[model samples]
Target: MSPDFLLLYVNDPDASAGFYGKLLDRAPLDARPGFVMFKLDSGMRLGLWGTETVKPAPNAPGGFEIGWPVGSDADVDQMADDWAARGISIIQQPETMGFGRTFTALDPDGHRLRVYQPALRP
Candidate 1:
């Protein structure tokens, strides 16, 4: 099955939603006391749910990164610059790795947000 929904456990749904809204430059599709949702331009759904309301307690944020593959190395660098200018926390500076050029940032809840350009094949 194709993965469509990506859910994140956040300390405060509204606050997290605000952060994402500003970064994505898109208003949330749904917002409530402990929940918010956004439909990304790619037709992917992103959900922010309050940690306290989760059925089972979550370990912590930042354990895994959400990888966003861009078209080129320049694209990755450009995005990194944009995010940095927007006041996003840049945990990892842009650099070329075995996979390609990449950079990482953190959300309000410390969730890893990475953008990369895949290394070209021979």
Candidate 2:
């Protein structure tokens, strides 16, 4: 069996759509007033729907945010620059942890998303 895609529900579709659009450099697919979808290169679809309509899975606190993995610290820097330029809130500046470098951003519904990748392979 194979896994399908994931969809997130947000309080504001326009803000969520705009955020993902700038981040992904493309407009959402199958967009409607109440929903939008991002078709990632990984064949996984990230979708946004009206918050009031979502039914969270058991054992889940609503739905957790998504992430984008970059290749290096430089890439993380560039991502933060781009996101800031687009007026998206960068909750945390890029910083190196024991495992890697990362930055967090809050989406429309206040979900925190972190983008990161391995610092080095041990």
lDDT of 1 at 88: 92
Q: Best-fitting candidate, measured by TM-score?
A: 1
Candidate 2: misplaced stretches above 4 Å? 55-63
C-alpha displacement of 88 in model 2, angstroms? 1.1
Prediction 2 TM-score vs. true: 0.83
Q: How big is the positional error of residue 74 in model 2, measured in Å on the Cα after superposition?
A: 1.1
The digit string of per-residue lDDT tens for model 1 on 1-122 reads: 79998999898899899899998889999998888999998899999989888778887654656888899999999999999998999999999999889999999998999999999889
1-122 per-residue lDDT for model 2 (tens digits): 87667877677778888887887889787788778888888988888887655665223223476778898898988988887887778889999998799998777677677889877776
Ten contiguous residues with the weakest lDDT in model 2 = 54-63
User: Of the candidates shown, which would achieve the greatest lDDT relative to the real structure?
Assistant: 1
What lDDT score belongs to each candidate, Candidate 1 first?
0.90, 0.79
